[model samples]
Target: MKLRFLPLVAVLLAGHATAQEAVFQTKSLTPEAALKAAQAALESCRKQGYQIAVAVTDRTGLLQVLLRDRFAGAHTVTVATDKAWTAASFKTSTLEFGKDTQAGKSMSGIRQVPRVVAAGGGLPIEAGGTLVGAIGISGGPGGEADEACAKAGIKAIADALEL
Candidate 1:
């Protein structure tokens, strides 16, 4: 009887150890949520006296929402989307690449990735250490300013999501 019970306990322990659970499960933003993110960022940028373009990308780096404030240069929209894609795909801030390459770290491989901009202004939207996606902003006075706005938008959304 003791030997039989030992096998049962061993099996239970193994099952518990191998129990798999979702980590950073993917989150899909409702259209309203996406719009709010864009709008809030736009308002924030305007308050700072900057006309900016903002883009939100999904976990896979695909465009989910994009908006460009009136008077923002067309180029900004393109850059915003590209930066968001880069961050979502790389699972890190685009600023990381900028700093790394500026330090002469031989970014040949990184440069080869067509979607990567290696510029500041894009940040990953993470939940529990897992990347949910990314947001990017452009058309501000500087890339750092754009990055700040993007981060603010991400924070707003993260708060709403209760993450």
Candidate 2:
């Protein structure tokens, strides 16, 4: 009787193992690509006469690159990194997130989350219809300028990320 049950259990376990995937694949930006994006953002801000700091993060919100202009403020580092992390983690542009979470809005409480920056400088990096990473820029005149620089950064790496 016990032998009969053991075979059943074995079959059940084997079926379960074949039914679920043991591992899944995910895409992320390479370190070199992240550096290129950061450099492009910094250059874009510089062209606009705005000293800034740029940060890039992988899909998992892990920092991949960070670049700061000589005249950028010290605080820009933390702000840039937070912006990148927020964009990647939230899977949305920080500017949109900010508007959605503004005071008196239903998502206002999200503003209180640690490392969650809802500024315009952060943008998600998507390729092949998948989010690959994020970029953030800080130390510009305002969120708009920072966002513009971040856009330039994405544009610079657009072709390579087409895959």
Judge candidate 2 against the unseen true structure and give its global Cα lDDT, from 0 to 1: 0.93
Number of clashing residue pairs, candidate 1: 0
Candidate 1 lDDT at 158 equals 78
CA lDDT for candidate 1? 0.80
RMSD of 2: 3.9
lDDT of 1 by residue, 1-163 (tens): 7887998999998887777442334575666666677777777889899998999887787888899988999899889999989888877787786787664577646766676788888888776666767788888997788888887787677766665
Query: Can you tell me which runs of candidate 2 are displaced by over 4 Å?
Result: 1-20
Against the unseen true structure, what C-alpha lDDT does each candidate score?
Answer: 0.80, 0.93
Clashing pairs in 1: none
* lDDT value, residue 2 of candidate 1: 86
Q: Which pairs in model 2 have colliding backbones?
A: none
lDDT of 1 at 44: 80
